[model samples]
Target: MKTIASTNSSAFGEPGIFRGQARFGSPMLSDYVWPLLEIRGQRPGPRLCVSAGVHVNEVSSIEAAIRLQKLFDPKAISGSVSIIPLVNQPALYKYSEYICPIDGKNINFTFPGSKGGTFSEVLCDAIMNEWCAGSDCYVDLHGGDLRENVSKFSIYQRTDDAGLEAMGRRMAMCFDAEIVVGLPKDHMQRPGRPPTGFARHGRLALMSEAGANGLLDESSISFHVEGVLNIARALGILDTPMSAFRNARVACNDYLWVETPVDGEFHAEIEPGMRVTKGQRLGAMRNLFGEEIAEITAPETGLVLWRMTHPSLPKGSSVLAVAVEETQVGQA
Candidate 1:
């Protein structure tokens, strides 16, 4: 890792800024610290902020951030690169929860939060005021929550706004994830949206899923590391080739959710990156007595993008897949 001074302030503190957990006091656990590496290049460029561990258990992104920080030399970079690997350190450490242990709030959903709120919300506000709201671009790193493993992919919001789309697409190309999922809608309108979640508006942000939940998978880790490098190069921060870009960019607008018919022991017959047809049986559910409870099928022809790894589920638990069709409403 690149050795730099670790100071205890966000700005006006030091150049090699490593702000330790500043006290937000009791009502909010200020334990979740923000680590930023401000490498001012010889020439100025766009500010890129990469955040990981917002969900805690999705450890790949955190590892990727560490690896990138070490290998990332600001002298070689064109602009600033800020990284907050453990955004939800409370959850990652104490409770070992996917969401924040203090309040069970998802850090991702609690963005642009209030100053005097709960731990997660306050941290969210701090992050917004300290990191995200100021940056030119933000990359929210995530792995599939708990049971779900994800294909190497990034998400971009698809809207009529072309500028946002362009930025997202460029980052997607640099990251070169297996597929690029488009999230057109914001988190608020989302049926089962988490209270503290990502903003689904006109923001220049991208979500990258590296591997499964819980542990660090090497393959996914390597991909994430390389993905960051690729983005750096593509954004003109590093001198390199963009040929590392791999996988097709699948839009989120062209995808659909695969839900379970009834609550039971869910199983998946297909993996995240598999291609399937409309009538294909993606998976099934069974009861405690080994009796088949419900059969899950694809609604349309497309590729299986994500599925639930947690089998013991409740009613309406999203079981298997989001498919991106070859041709959809708008593909040009």
Candidate 2:
């Protein structure tokens, strides 16, 4: 491979680091670039790629990626680590919009994208094809957006590849979040496949979520930073032992999405990570005159994975996401 910033191919075989930008095409006014950080260890091992800011509003993940870039030292690792701290610079620069303003599409839904497609698609294409083509592992960091309040959790795909699935599970466990979700083969396939679409193309991939509501809480940021370091230790990239969290990891095989029954101002009575029983009241919707328009109830007993942070709710808008715990099928 060719060299870009400071480090060269020789550094890939020895301890060194490189910092540069992966340039894509230009917009009307300025050039498009994704900041890239590459760290090569003294000993050769797996190539672990970490990225965040796919959803620009997920600021905690972005900050975690930034902190992780400075924490890793090439002399202390056994493999290479590549980090893209902020993936959607345009969206991020545009006040943390959920979708790219240029194309009005969620970049996370566009994977293995087309070079000739819209702005988001072209950006995804460059990242997947040029930056993350071959890798032993991949972690897409995310958190709740400006209008999302969510608990910390990690998700991994339950794939046909046993080895890849196992690796993904281990990485998820290493994150040690409050919950570990196993997405089925067909999870989130509509609109477009998630970034985990890389798994179908033969890469061990996982995603971590923390922080929410466009706030940068230090606790949330620390959780993500520690999760990445824990995964590194699990992968043997770092010699440090795994650190345990307070809660035992809970596993979920599916999620239930609750949508608003009427358009009104929403007031959530429950928070993420809270447990709810079937038929329990989760929140309520009120009309403009402050009259109760509808009551939001839990569909089943489960943990609240995420809740809508926005005060106003439109009819049919998703307000809460509950992760249903159940039996584990197939081989781990």
Q: Candidate 2's residue-wise lDDT over 1-332, tens digit each?
A: 23356443333334687787666543531356667888888888778889998888888889899988888888899888899998878776686567877788888777756767788787766666667667777788888798898788888877787887788888888776888887776753532333256666766777888988888888788878888888888888999877778655688776678999899988999999988877899999999899998999988777899998887989998999888676533323
What is the C-alpha lDDT profile of model 1 across 1-332, one tens digit per residue?
Answer: 12234453435222333433333333454333455555455567777777787777777777887777776664576776777677776765563546777787766666556677777777766565555555666777777567887777776665556776677677765666667766554533542122113334455666777778667888787777877777777677788775555576665445577777687998788888877777888888999998998899987777777788889888876776665653654533
TM-score for each model = 0.83, 0.90
lDDT of each structure? Answer: 0.66, 0.78
Candidate 1 global Cα RMSD: 4.3
The best candidate by lDDT is 2
Task: State residue 1's C-alpha deviation in candidate 2, in Å.
Answer: 9.5
Clashes in each model (backbone N, CA, C under 3 Å)? 6, 0
